[model samples]
Target: MNEIFVKSLPLKDVIANIAEALDTTYFNRCNEYILNIPEIYGEGSIRGINFLNGFGLIEYNCTLKEALKIHFNVNSIHPLKFIYCSKGSVKHKFEEHDVLHQIEQFQNIIVASTQQNGHILIFPKNENIHLNSLEISRKEFKTKIDCDLNILDVGLKKLFKDLTARNLFFYQGNYSLAMSDCIDTIKTSKFSGIARSLFLEGKSNEILSIQISDYEDDKKDIPKRQILRKSELVQIQKAVQILKSELSKPLTIKELANKVGTNPTKLQEGFRYNFGLTVNNYLNKIRLDYAKEQIMIGELNISEIANNIGIANKSYFSRLFKATFQLNPKEFSLQIAKNANKRQRNRPLT
Candidate 1:
């Protein structure tokens, strides 16, 4: 196992420390630090960005050849950490605690070690580990003009105000689908310069707020919070049925979302989580499947088939059909007709 100690304060120093320990180097872009893993070590990179108000984002996407242990041993009051495992599981243990927590895919954990204590993150060997950590320095966070920590509810106020780390804090639960989208945006962000800095900072703040809300909802034991509610499932099913029944009519995502009594965001998420396809893609699949069935039935020509399956243009339908099945709709339909005629001719006299 390889052990890397990050004895630093901010993201820049932390990334620099890792890069140095591995005998490689890191680069800086608009205050964001990126450490590309040396080929001798593994394939992947560790990147991080820090905002002025003490919030930071660290992304680790890697498949290391051996087990790696990253120890954050910064002294003084350590930064609060909101860690989310997006792809693979990771093991974590506070320096002051013996219990190790495993954060699996789609799960998050909020951890704050006691004063001068630190965090241990363990990534198993040869696994695709992808996670993001939102770190906030409470002492510095309180100084932000808009912080207004006192206005926050009692529990969050106390949790954020533990400057001396009087209480060791740790909470774990599945993250919300909305937060998953935010994280995905962070991953796919292409901005640079001031835009990059501002965008990342905004997203980091959003993730933190969602994390807080999720924690509060967890404490309240809200069944409809992070977990998908029955209503949502029913709406998803209803959306599918609507699409199936309206094969000759295409609906916009907004229209579908509205008919289901849900917003576009939730509808999009429902499709992603439950159906594993985008709304438009799923609709197109349904229409094309119906068109195939209609063609195989030998009742409609290509143009009629397209019209019946919500495709106004035969050329477009043909392109989609070819793309999906690698066969022309007209040829496929004629072949079906030919097969039926041949079978009819081969039948024995009754």
Candidate 2:
């Protein structure tokens, strides 16, 4: 856990640009700082700023002496905030909506997005506020578990009790390393966008997995089937292995789970438990990954790759492929062709 300081807004801008390139409408114009929440939303407007565009999580450490400002709306939507208390207690003021509330000492807070714009605040004080945001997707989120909203406040508090010690010892002045690892996890996975949505929407599976991973590392005993359990942990590796071996075969959650000696429920839970994705999501990831490889090789047509990956419906497969890789199969093929042509032209005639 090396520590490196980062300015959040620039990172947000990079994410917004990527979202625009990917055509993610939700993050089309997400350009604002997390500290400046009001700028992200317009009064009486439906658009909310998308931090998910970056495809990673964020954390904050701050203290307030004034009441944080918030907006309100009449739309039925999701809640988007995770708060925790390390020292002083804070109060909620929502006349328009009954926001689900939680408060705990020395825990983490999570902020999720809803359908409409609303406001929330922590009691401003001289006390330092430490917060962490871990991006995740809806499918990877554990809505069925018992989660303390306040736990979202203390970033990864469930993993390490001695925040100062862990921060000082493990992080060892390399916060950027931690951030890099998180960003890499998102970039390498197919559940990239969904992970951000889940984190903002108070989805607990991502946080739980983080907690469980930390607990196991610390040699702590947890009773439930945590995400890091050996049986559960192996499914992701198995899915990846199977996907790599059978890229040309049709994949189903039931089949994959059965092959790994687990049911769909456990398979789904565990796949997302260790990785920030469900079984099906992982399958899509592999399909798309292979699609890219085939394009680069330029030995297969779009339909061939689609059908080979068990995507019989060309239109739907094309859409899913584009959504995952940010380019239609044709476009991807053309780009690869362009690169090959460029290389060939640059080669000296023998």
Candidate 3:
């Protein structure tokens, strides 16, 4: 058994204390706390930024050299956390539960723990973990709902039903692609200072909205014609990786299916079931997003971007871009340039 570090405080203070305990330096910008742990902790880092007074975003990326357990006994208010494990895994042990709840990669977990008896997180050694969490204090959450808890999704309502109850509620599910995209944007954003904080805050709230909407959609009685088994799910994910890796090549659905050792039907159904997009739609989305990124870089022309993304018909690519982003490729490129110019002009004299 590894040694556990226990702390009883509000969430933000707990994060700062963890950095201090590990002898790390942290930046306390207005509402953002960026903690960079030393090499002794295996290059661990945590970024916490508050949006509202009691609502915030936490991004954790680390490879620990030793096991660390953080037991958080909430001091001020019971907190509700919406957590996504993007890269690795984590285990949560509640005070009242004997079983450890596992949050694996590509999964989301929602937890509401009482202030009197909070939860614990155990991080194992030598494994790279990336987690993004959206935390809201109970009081703030209730205020946002106008004190009408009934407006929450059934799953969320159950998790937060009895705020005064001294028990922990946990719900775990597969996160949708929309949520994943938001997380990736937040992770890879190049903005800094106030721009960075605002970007993170907006994306965090977008993730929360997507999660709640997805939960409600799951509750609806959608037809289950394309049910995929566990092994088939793995195969489809491999296909996705292959598609992403070979983006420069124009691969047909048949080629993709054969490469992943699955039939075309199963591959198509898997995309629909797991990713909520048809085969062509998904591939087009990938290509368009890549093209838009290249435009943002301001390095490639519209036709060159189209060619690089394997689309020879520039007009068709422009139409796809319009449909996806409501902006044609040229218009989007000009917008990026305009924004860059504005940022340069707005820079303060130092």
TM-score of each: 0.68, 0.35, 0.65
What lDDT tens digits, residue by residue, belong to model 1 across residues 79-122? 98989988889999998888999998889998888877899999
Q: Rank the candidates by lDDT, best first.
A: 1, 3, 2
lDDT of 2 at 291: 82
**In model 1, which residue pairs have backbone atoms overlapping below 3 Å?**
none
For residues 1-350, write the lDDT of model 2, one tens digit per residue: 11112122233542343234323433332232233222222111112233332224433344433333323221333233333233344443333356534333333344333333333433344444434434333322333222643454343443223311212111101121122234344334444345545534333334435543443333323333223333245556776788778866756777886687656665676666556797678778878888888888878888888888888899998899789878888887887788888999999999
**Residue 350 CA error for candidate 2 (Å)?**
7.1
Candidate with better TM-score, 2 vs 3? 3
Candidate no. 2 TM-score: 0.35
Of candidates 3 and 1, the better by TM-score: 1
Q: Which of the two candidates, 2 or 3, achieves a greater lDDT against the reference?
A: 3
The C-alpha local distance difference test score for the whole of candidate 1 amounts to 0.84
Estimate the TM-score for candidate 3.
Answer: 0.65
Clashes of 2: 35
Clashing pairs in 3: none
